[model samples]
Target chain A: MGAPFNYDVLDLTDEQVDAEVRVFGALTAAVRRLNEATLRTTVDHATVEEVRRQVEELTARLEKSMIPDNFGVSFTKGGRIRGYGNAVVGIRNPNAVPLTVVQDKVNGRASAEFELNALHEGPPGQVHGGVVALVLDQVFGEAAAAGGSPGMTGTLTLRYRLNTPLGPCSAEAWVDRRDGIKTIVKGELRRADGTVTVTAEGIFILPRWAREEIAKNGGTPPQFE
Target chain B: MGAPFNYDVLDLTDEQVDAEVRVFGALTAAVRRLNEATLRTTVDHATVEEVRRQVEELTARLEKSMIPDNFGVSFTKGGRIRGYGNAVVGIRNPNAVPLTVVQDKVNGRASAEFELNALHEGPPGQVHGGVVALVLDQVFGEAAAAGGSPGMTGTLTLRYRLNTPLGPCSAEAWVDRRDGIKTIVKGELRRADGTVTVTAEGIFILPRWAREEIAKNGGTPPQFE
Candidate 1:
């Protein structure tokens, strides 16, 4: 890799970070519930319009009362605050499947548990094939980053072996190899019954810009462990 | 790969499909607005809790009055009725980026246009890198299917060329080659100024089970054109 991952720890306590993550998690859960309701709601047109107006007004009110920008990612000595507004694993993103992941650096592996609700469906009863790709890519990237090299995704390859059914699913990934600036990771999504649904391989690279940014900031990147 | 694409005309007017698509598009747009607001809102704790409760109550009411489940994909004679509840491009999915895609079979190519809002952010002021993968996979799959080889994704490789900004972006994909069951498609996501942000190549395979399912059901598969 161009340079080792590094980050300067912030002076935040673990308790504070946990509380923040929990609060965001609650909000995301509520929003997810709302999203599903929106998809399946079939109320009369009048009722629908009324509810829409109320939601719009609420949005306007909140906008007027809230901060103007996002509180991007933050780091602390404990680790990279995992609950930053990440689209993939952020507890604050209602769009996320909100996978709970465990990275095992000693074993050079990472695993996640998640459920694909109706919101993720593609085929009538199966998970969207593309969603499968999305999950696999995230897990594989995590695996690559876990191996002491935090790099941006250079390439991701996936194989759909079977239709991933909607409901609980598990995924696991591991670093298969590394070549200087390139790190290759392999992973698979599996059903509860251990039936493999999708398999993936990805190549991650430490770009020059990322290296320069890390160097300029004088921050140490968090190790996957 | 497993079987050639096939389809039988259904009795559906283009007007009917367009009308339905538009209706769903409006609903998704509303939901998308709600999602963005949920992300950026920063009201006081008391007000936030109050709004959350109200949203919850509304959700409960809607649940009692709405449809029981999603109205999965539907096919029509004019085409595949591309506006099905697809997780990627379906107008019915509030979670989707809602890319507007046009598959030009006459030229053996496919392209899409979409915008990423604050909700899709990963890094500060930038579109989430995983989202780039998500969009590319869908476009590449569309390209493979556009070439008359409507298969599942076998493998997809993406190269991040530059940071995709959080705003209007366009992507295009085309078949590079085909080998029996495998179709290779190449694509790139570009900024409004035509700066290439990410490039990808994917291999798609028509699985044996999918071929059998089409044969069992009297349903004809939609052609890419």
Candidate 2:
């Protein structure tokens, strides 16, 4: 209602930006706490119900500041956040399905872990194969991003090593090499016992559009941390 | 119940194989008809509604053969007729998601088309990006499989060029090359106006498991054509 929408420019009020950052930090902390509980506790039916209620409350609060259009990530004065309101990787929402990315910089390797609850399961007792791909894609993309080149997904191939269990699980990805426009990254998912569940490798391309966007914004390209 | 359950393979008399074959043939023919109609028509609300009714009726008949477990594709008796029954490419049921793939062998190119009906859509109005990836992966994998190797998805990467229209759309995939264990394939989706919507590429691997499975089954891999 404030202004007509145009793709040319992204406008965010200072208050909106502050609110988004606060919400994102809260969400990150909440997910971490929930994940910790899931990993540490027995997590019976009652616990699951309690967790669900907490998630619902979080969802309600996040809905208030929801932007009508998909919001892109921004580096504010502080570099604490990225993609605050993006559809897949948005940080400022209860529904933002976040993936925890851990990097082994010395080894040039990286891994990620997340517990998908009822919100993520696709098959009856197994995680949806597509969901597995979604997580793998993000994890692998981030792994490549961490490897001095952040590229968009060009092609990803996954092998279903086994039917992934729907409960607590972990995933890992690491960089293979850089070949021209392609950044090859390898990734895998596993149960707590370390059974190789799904193995994947991806070729991410430095997209022309994203590069143009970076240039237009007067920003240097993102580099490996 | 005529035999406890309708399509229990254990209960199916030898004679029922012929009946099953006939029924399957009819279903295939019906799917072909639907495909033809889809190509010929604009597929407006009235058209979709009409088609939905027909789909419902056909689905009911197909559901009559409700086996206890999922019906995986099968071939026996010297491949007289391959059971595309459980193929994820058929149009009749929700399970296969009914992909329409067309290969231009003369040009060594292929394209696939399908609709994201009420069942498949995750986000509002826009087709789920993951669903788009699923169809692309299947078609791209099949394209690689067409080129002698018969590989599985080793990696797939997609760039969401645009929010794919919820209604009628098309997908295309082509074999790029083979490098050792990786068969490189490229693919895309487009709207009716021929605008390139989504672009994808995948590295398909000729997994050791599939090779062994083919050898155990004996003879050439079942011809996809």
Candidate 3:
């Protein structure tokens, strides 16, 4: 038989990967718009039922393009994709906003930035509290990863300093302290004005999955999938 | 003029409330089904456009009704209806779930339970990890409320001991310790088999809003909302 249907076959150019990321973001924005319109209307059984039906149809249309059934992870001769499974825009997941996370060795620090859309709202005219925590967990985990331990967040503690508006925001994380599996990472999500709305401390664990996966890949960690 | 329209004045018999809860559960399940099918289908652009049109029509029809509009909290004189709002039923919110929290006589013991439907998925066959934390935070806050603090979560931490399966699950909480303003609480979410999928600890603070609300209410702690 021919070589297995590996991700290597679909070697995408850097430009193509960039385009994929953009498409995912646009689609997420569209979904958020639809959601807002639906919520702003009157509430009733019919409204509920109709929204459900319409959402069903929209979903069917969106997934028409069959990406590989496997999870988002890739390793090739070129480079590795990091922080690819973010719910909004991900290279491996066409459905999320595959955010590109980077660690700047020049500064020996980790930072990330991404745009938020309507799909992430919790209260009226505000982003969901949990989404803020999710991003914080990811950013903090990135910091932990910098120290050679990619992990799953074991405990994440967040204070909703304020109502985080839905729009462009940046997150930064730095290793504050470490005690074996208990890594204390401090992270913040800030607005364009540099006002911080969310702050977090997370304790992440070097789960068995990540440890084994790293060893199997010859020390090349498949970016957070 | 009639009292300003209070959004909290509808009443149902215990049986009626239970029935509404059941319907709410079913509708949430349908939303999930819609999400999964949408993610897996391969419809053409033209078909998707057509579906969008149908959705608009459904939206119009649903808006014509008023039940979901008239849903929310309610209080009345005697057993009869004085004012009424939808109390966790009436699909006014796609993401809404009814939480019933009961505080114990002891200073820091409390318990809560609620149902999750399709609108709360993260991974393929599991409850979204963030949602798990959301539920935990709310319950732990409720437990702190047991001590009559009526505080907000300053720092909430969760451990994903295992993947929480999609279906009926029970969660519980109790006071762990107290240090002045910070009331530490612990809780867990479990499947029917008693396997704890998630556990949490929270630091709750007696926020300014709560303190003021309590004082204005004649020092009697407000019941769970």
C-alpha lDDT of candidate 2 relative to the true structure: 0.52
Sorted by TM-score, highest first, which candidate order results?
1, 3, 2
Docking quality (DockQ) of candidate 1: 0.41
Q: In candidate 3, which residue ranges exceed 4 Å CA deviation?
A: A1-27, A43-48, A56-105, A108-131, A145-149, A159-170, A177-183, A189-198, A213-220, B1-32, B38-131, B145-149, B159-170, B177-182, B190-193, B209-224
Top candidate when judged by lDDT against the true structure: 1
Better DockQ candidate (1, 2): 1
What class would a CAPRI assessor give candidate 2's docking? incorrect
Candidates in order have lDDT scores of: 0.70, 0.52, 0.54
Instruction: Specify the poorest-scoring 10-residue window by lDDT in model 1 chain B.
Output: B1-10
lDDT of 2 by residue, A1-225 (tens): 111111222355566567645544453434423322222232233433443344333333333343433332334443434443322344432233455567676655667667654334332234545567766766776788777667666666677765565567888888888899888888799986788988877777766765665577676655322
Q: Which numbered prediction scores highest in DockQ against the true structure?
A: 1
- Cα deviation in Å at residue A167, candidate 3? 7.8
Q: Score candidate 2 by TM-score against the native.
A: 0.48
Please provide, for model 3 over A37-90, each residue's C-alpha lDDT reduced to its tens digit, 9 standing for 90 to 100: 343344544445656655665655655664333233444345545223333333
Compared with the true structure, what per-residue lDDT tens digits does model 1 show for residues B1-225? Answer: 111223334577888667645554565677677677666766655666666777787677657775545545555766555435567776667788877778877655789988887667655556767778777777877787777777677777777877776778999999999887789898899997899988888888767766777777766554422
- Measured against the true two-chain complex, the DockQ scores of the candidates, in the order shown, are 0.41, 0.05, 0.20
What's candidate 2's DockQ score? 0.05
Model 2 misplaced regions, further than 4 Å = A1-68, A87-89, A223-225, B1-187, B191-194, B197-225
